[model samples]
Target chain A: MTTPRRRSQQDLSVHKRQVENLQRRLLLKEMLSLGALGMLAGCDLQDGDAVDKVLWTMSRWNDRVQAKLFSRTRLAPTYEASRITRPFPFNAFYPEYDAPDIDGAAFRLQLSGKIDDKRAWTLADLRALPQSGQITRHICIEGWSAIGEWRGVAFRTFLERIGADMTARYVGFKCADKYYSSLDMETAMHPQTLLALDFGADPLPAEYGFPLKLRVPTKLGFKNPKHIAEIFVTNDYPGGYWEDQGYNWFSGV
Target chain B: MPVHPLPIRVFHWLNAFAMTCMATSGWAIYNASPLFGFTFPAWATLGGWLGGAVAWHFAAMWLLAGNGLFYLAYGLASGHFRRRFLPLSPSGIMTDLLAALKFRLPHEAGTYNAVQRLLYILVLLLGVLAVASGLAIWKPVQLWWLSAAFGDFATARYVHFLAMAGIVGFVAVHLILVVLVPRSLLPMLTGRHSSSHEVSS
Candidate 1:
């Protein structure tokens, strides 16, 4: 058999491809090495997205794409009467100055925002509407938690009475102590939400947002803004006191 | 004259430095919360700021891993790895291992012997485990697959914490060994392992 004098075109093409493949692999390795060093040197800085923002973005996208199997009722488990222990760690606006005592004449709920009808309603008016009560856990971001039964007019009913504008996206709770909180429209209208007035069958203590406080079951303790000064319904994402301080406004438990 | 290749020496000590930083910061983070039976006291403060702790730990991790990768790759490509690790036969390895345990070494013993080989391998392997487990705990969702390897999220956190304990133990022993053999420590620092003839041997 005669020895091959020269490589065929096909053989040359195959050899060329192999060389290209090897070159690509080598290039990739070099890039990875450079990338690792780049991280070490703290290069490749970009702006406009913090780590928490990234997490929230991811969470929102995840929620939209993959609906989590959250319990629909949104009710917290109630403990036995005997189990109710000393001083359930109270939170939010307390001890209203305007109305030290239960003065129905003085207490008036003011509501204003994106609405054709913007006005105040009395506690009698709220009580006249359909009411709801549920035992729910008050989860604090500081890592402590408590469970309490809240009784009041359903937020959905209140929203209807106030003629909440269809375009409104957030409900900003203007509180007594200059403390403000905002809730997303979806959470604001959630079935378990309430404009709470009673704690465990007793009238809410002045320290625990007497007369009226927003009871949003799914939120952390901070989001339930107390001693409601006024309720401002807005069509924009309203940044709250906590949100300005780098805490997420939507403190969903 | 060669001074143990600049990157290799730098990477070596840099790894040791980063390892110590991680251990110290990790101790602080662990003491911040009590989970499982690993209860550290409330007073022990290795890092005063949680944010700083997180930043430094992540920064050190990147540096340690990068240096380790480069060193390993360079050594293997340059045939230094084979010279350092691969050539010894099992019989020679066993003999050297026994000699090391007994604090004995014959003439012409290599820079690293059999027991050193095992310990070196373990150190690298444990470093890798530390990084993997750390990532699993740090970003459970980001590196969910890694976390899944050690079971659920909490379990992975526990494992990562335990792995840091392992690293601390290794470092303690490593320091003791260096103190016992000042000659070995000198080479590591000065990048020169003088011949036995130069010593009192």
Candidate 2:
């Protein structure tokens, strides 16, 4: 135990050092590029490939800063029923017509990783749990926003019911449409985060994540995984489809 | 003829580049989920992808904010605001506007006309508004007060968009004026002007 603790401490120090080094390097690169601008007239340093890496580093740094500043007590603004956007636009990797057609009767939510209960939960099991609803804005990263009413069980409640390890670093989801996403445990436990089973007053439609969707209003649209299949709690970083392609993993509004 | 100060020129050019990048990338980002009933073509924007546009927008946002803060500080410390942009009488602005409309305004080398001064000041204020509204939209939860001040996130976005339009209009007129008086570009470029080009103030 002592050896493991010492190694973990060393690893943490190394990680901290790496972050500091990256920040210092980014700053130095910015200054060097600015200086070079005057010496090399009309030479655009921003066009360089290294600039992309620097920007990504800066973006990651921004993510860390945002995460540190995030407040669990602060909630996303809720709206009145009248304020909800009608025909809340369908958005996904595929067209609305291509939405996954899952058999609700046969559907089972698989739970794994750091959980005392590894049983598959049926729709009835989820429906039997306590329910909550919120009329909140869905802010898309694409710059559009729509307000919708989401009714579901509080994610923390569901996690607790399933005996998920709340101390885990991440809670990841796999979806029926090959979509996957993970949330920081802090966000996962936020009061407003829900495992949504219904939209507005009706049961969730196929086009709107029939079986289940993770409604995380504080995050951008894509962070809310739809048609959730498997949920896992782990310390391992579970990168999402868009996240792997350079979207900030912690894409909070 | 008095040329623009070195710091002013540097700030001006840097601001120009930053705004161009910000606006173009902003358009691209907007195109992802367009407003005002139409979308800008992908070919017209700086970054092809929404992700790329977002990256560019953020990168340029830092440049614009940093340079603008520096410019504001220098303007304050050096009394540039008072000397060049203030003490404008309503009558003088009206006179300048009439003269400009009638195409009879004199091009003074060392000073700005009242109309020019007012427009410049307006554009500067709009730039600040753009940044503030942008911050509100960018981090509505983090900067809750700013978003609240604008009523909501939707309102803040509208304000940001309007500010961008205002700045774009100002730039359009500014470019036209520069083209009409091409000599004005020289002092801004090299921080110096030939004595022959100087007109009596």
Candidate 3:
């Protein structure tokens, strides 16, 4: 009986050691994976072929993901006359069109990736869509707040017109003003959000994403892309300019 | 000699100074963008004035953090720190605390009296929490790892604000104690308190 009991105790000890070893290995594996991701993110610093290919690959994947996701969601909601807010705050940096390259006729918004029809939509084409309006609060990450009335077309309707594929998962926007931003499909389709053309019944001010901009009410103002030039739908996560610099990609209020 | 030595006198005073600045500047910032219904309008900065308050607060934070790191390193190397202040048995601490509360100093009170020991430890821990939460709310992106400790950006802000309030309360009490016992203040200021020795003698 003593021999049997001793043998069982030793077996239990061995089992405990095995479990501990496996746990340690799992933790190390996770750490290694994070290190790899960080390395990939930092790889942009080194120049030439390998880096360019990786960025291009990532950008292509990002475009496909964006379209599929936004189609599933609805556009920003419109507000009634009574709900219209006064003194709409415009917090974007003044004189937004610093880049000399933004000419209205020459400025074409390219819509491609994960679509049956890849086409360039002139400014007039976007204006033809059914428009929406909403009065919502713009929350800044810097602990400031403002309210504005925005007018834009339903982003979902735009996706539908383009015949976005089911495989696409996100709505990635590339701004003409060198501003790069992206959003998940769920947020892109939120009923209170918009791809705004007008602010408070007026054309979008240059400082506040003039010509075209995004309005995601539930998120901090930084997530709202301004001066949109390209709309690509993608199945993978697209990196935002701020996100690459360590800002919260979610930016949820 | 301790594995973790007591912080340098300059560091102690500088830390105290920076903490005071942060408390005052933080209050200024809070008055402008108040989360609570409560408002301190008199303390509120008008318009861009709040921006200056933020700058000063952040500058003071850098000073406090730099000094704190130096102190931590010194303590770890010098063997000055133990599990508890006063280095007495728990029962002894209880008795000493009771005596100090009653304004009756115990005969066996160490470098830090029972009251001083508890307050000091609390202040140290609160300082750490304040820094962590500040980083969380300030550059949540740059310091994402720190934000993880406090949950999210807004939640981290709440914790940071609460910790600042605690530090402010502690400062008020600390000031009152200093006034009540000038001898204690003298030691902190001059590093050799004549009055403290007189009392012990």
Candidate 4:
């Protein structure tokens, strides 16, 4: 009797949260669609010949193709420290000055969906996890690429520790910068995928996602989300910020 | 005699359409962070922006690759490449090149001259290089050896760009030749040789 009551209560809150999220997103899309950036990324709006729909369908189809092409044994090349790009470029949807500043002591990584633990983790807890470092290139969707060093917990290990449903279809991230992204299960489980906590020899600078950043060297730069505040594992498709636009969903590089 | 056979004409037109889509969108993508000092003009590009360009580029990639592969298989299996493009010697090419410079080289229907054969072979090789280099840039991690073969990631981009440039040059010369010999377009369009075509090897 108690268990049924508890489930009903949870369901009600979840439904309410969904409605609120929808309203927020509606407002955001409307505001964004008013600008020149909208013209560049205007798939959500009506288009001549429904060109946007065709492109989006093709992008989704490419996602499946890339998934088939991905091999578990394939590893993104690692460079020597000397080859690491000097003055590594900083990239974000917003300008550099607008990068969020959060208090480290108050930070907590919220976890939900398919996670057995369902408990938030602090910076200290994250630091205590087994860690590794890598020097790898970050290939952007545009055209340029950069190499950098990052040290953090392997994402598979982190997911295992959190008791994530390993078979889940997607691992989604909600970033403090209002940026969000999702990954296919295979990519999420890649050995090199990291919940990066440090950049170079320093703790991650706020500008580079001080608390956490998803470092996926095998994917395009936008796939590696920064300033992560929440993580969820789900079977549902979690569309990304750029992905909801015209960019391909599986932007593997 | 058929100058351009039905299957060959089909493949040719399909390749032309696919190449146009890929090249125009690729130019738009190149504009985002151009490897060179300049970018393609807005009018020359297909997509309105980087994201749009990328979507078109990847989508058209399938058409180009599929049509090109079919074309290659058919060309080899039918012995078309052997019959039309064989006996290509450097001296023959030089002879044709010098004659062509004086505007006296013959355009024999149903036969490829040494210079024309050399250009076709070079362009075919460029097509393969462009696709391979494109895959390298698209998936440098999974296709690591491919990019490495070209020297690196950046080198792959360079190779892709050069291959595209070569194909564009070929297209320009091809169009000019068709304009000069207006009768040439008929064979491609109708897949038949109306003139008393020279079918000799």
Candidate 5:
């Protein structure tokens, strides 16, 4: 009995020492991470410059990983009509009052780059195309979500109709509101993606990307460029408004 | 008295650092497109801009998840969960709460009182909820089942926000208690405490 008690005391002491050693190691690691954070803090670099380059590099790496994992066939879930957020909020770089006023009769979607057809498209021409609609959630990067009904031509159909180079790596959009964005060919061809011309049952309202919007349900809200003016397919990267401002270029869901 | 085991101490600090980064960066991200009407000031948040905040948030998210997993595995494998957090009686917890409300510290040195155990368990559960809801929001389409479980994307965001609020509350209480009894931090820092020290029961 005495020998067993002595052995237990020795084992406890050994265990306590091991715990102390681990705690010390952890403390050291904690200090090291703190140092790294302090360095990051000290840099205090502006967006799109210096230290931000590292972050952008990391963002690009993340984009590659996401793109690699992206499945073309997988669709964003559609919601029921009852689930649609009433008064679907108008969100933009500008205020709702500042929504662009584009004339439907005069509005034309310009086409360019790596396409057989270079002719501009009038609103009527787009309306003549087969129409499709979906009620889907718009997930914002800022941590809020809203469901909205978007009605438009399937972007894949439009892309095919225009004789775009299906082999191209990117499909870039220039919006009338100066908010340009681009998508990977895979995302652009996603079945759920649309060239939205209407909101709910009405012709697309001025406050909701009048004339046309890219309704990309598989992406975060900012990636869905509104009030599209021009679309071009290219192998070269076409930077976007927010992407240039340091948001991730591939803001996929 | 037994001190915190090595794995527990390591995971604890790692989680603390990750959670701090997550909360601060999350605030910055939230300010970009606020859920409520108001926004957090730029100075108050860790990241200066929406993009910067997102970078920080993602980086810390990985750390939080990894550390949390390590903690969970260690707790379960070492029987720490059963010994320290379970077998909690409501009567004992109520007594500890009353004592706490009366400004009497109910804990003895190197041992948790019922109230501390319950709060710790609650915070642990909240952390799990935060991570789950975060995943639902982060990958709603890929993790469609999780999103559906939370009702929808908007509901998941709400739950995530609520979990964050709960964690913040726990942190505030924890910090206050640490200030009130600075010695409580020693075992966490050094993995040892004077066994002889005790509070009157």
Candidate 6:
């Protein structure tokens, strides 16, 4: 082959400089691609339904996968007392001040859906049930977690006592704060699932879903509803406040 | 032989699509509870809100994970990884680093240089980590052992973030390299007819 024309030293450096400049524009192109991405997402939202349907379908599939993964034998990790998040975070969509001030004496937990006992239970009645406690992590979908101590009656013990159908598919709560969530039967029957009435040696404070709250260490924090007004057991899927708004229904950890 | 096989091309493009959704939606998720001092800009993020972003993040997660596993299985079954990314060493990387710094490196089709090999290995491992760390975060309670291996639920978040950052950095460099060697893009797209990586120099 004939010899190719060789570049002068100056020409080579200048070519390198040109390459560097091209790389800068390439980064700019990547940013432009990001803009294209935003536009695609925007179209998916405005054009509607078709994409939403696919996403929701996949989400439902994931819920089933999560439900399958959940085990009644495995327990959420427990922490030492010293490791508890001091001044446990009061998290709710509503502000802390707006927390409902229910009359503890008059507050009664209402029961419904496949339960033989339709009568409500007072705070004392719940506390009188077999009480248990745990210092475990409460994971949030927002990507944060905190450890706290909660004491309450085992949900299974209470469920059995109230003659709830152990074979029921879902146990849902309607909270006084207008927040609602549901748990699969397997999770509801997990060893760590509690109907919490106390927080760290004190009676569960009003700010933290007092008189009654569901402490589910295995799932995200939102699945644990506070100031619970009604408990229902059923095979029908009872979607939650956030879950209805697009959060995963299973919300398992 | 095609420099990029059908399986490899499929994996590459699918990863491109999935990573786009994951990164953009992942940013939206990260913006929900920022680990750092600042957050990603809303305009740059994919999902409109936390819930929307989470749905996108999770939906794309399956794609990325499944695509990644497919790629891994293909690479192992085909012996493509050994042929393309082997013989990497610190000394080889150092030489390539010096040459790269001086703009003396050359691009050849169907072959990887030391630096490219190192980066590919790192990014592949990071991909595995991104998935593993995501699982650790997603199932800290159920996958308690996995979570504890990374220290805890919170630490898993950090690990997941680092994997994303590493992959992002790799993509920037990979894109820039593609720009520098535009010819390389065609094969990855259409599996152009060329000598495979097994060819002698």
lDDT, candidates in the order shown: 0.62, 0.83, 0.63, 0.86, 0.83, 0.86
Model 5, span B9-121: residue lDDT tens: 78988888889878877888877667788877665576676777787777678789989998888889989888887779999999888888887865566568888899999
Q: What overall lDDT, based on C-alpha atoms, would model 3 receive against the true structure?
A: 0.63
Candidate 5 Cα misplacement greater than 4 A, ranges: A1-54, A96-98, B32-42, B102-110
Q: Report how far residue A76 has shifted in candidate 6, in Å.
A: 0.3
Stronger candidate by lDDT (2 vs 5): 2
Model 2 scores a TM of 0.84
Chain A TM-score of prediction number 3: 0.63
lDDT of 3 by residue, B1-201 (tens): 321123556786788667755776576667756778875553322112343344446456767998999887776675455543646556766877777667777322126665666777788888899998987766443354676679756577789888887888898897666545443443343444232122321
Against the native complex, each candidate's DockQ, computed on alpha carbons, is 0.03, 0.12, 0.03, 0.20, 0.22, 0.39
Q: What is the TM-score of chain B alone in each candidate?
A: 0.82, 0.95, 0.82, 0.96, 0.94, 0.93
Off by over 4 Å in 4: A1-48, B197-201
Off by over 4 Å in 1: A1-85, A92-104, B1-201
lDDT of 6 by residue, B120-151 (tens): 99999999899889899999978889988899
- What is the two-chain DockQ of model 5? 0.22
Could you tell which candidate, 5 or 6, scores higher by TM-score? 6
Worst 10 residues of 4 chain B by lDDT: B192-201
Supply every candidate's count of residue pairs whose N, Cα or C atoms clash at under 3 angstroms.
1, 0, 27, 0, 0, 1
For model 5, the docking class works out as: incorrect
Candidate 3 lDDT, tens digit per residue, A160-192?
Answer: 788876446677888876778787766666666
Query: How do the residues A90-175 of candidate 2 rate in per-residue lDDT, one tens digit apiece?
Result: 99999999999999999999998999999999999999999999998888888888899999999999999999999999999999
Over A124-196, each residue of candidate 6 has an lDDT whose tens digit, in order, gives 8887888989999988889878899999999999999999998989999999988888999999999899999
Which pairs in model 5 have colliding backbones?
A: none
Interface RMSD, per-candidate values to 1 decimal: 13.1, 13.8, 18.7, 17.3, 4.9, 4.9
Task: Tell me what TM-score chain A of model 1 achieves.
Answer: 0.67
Candidates, ranked, TM-score: 6, 4, 2, 5, 3, 1
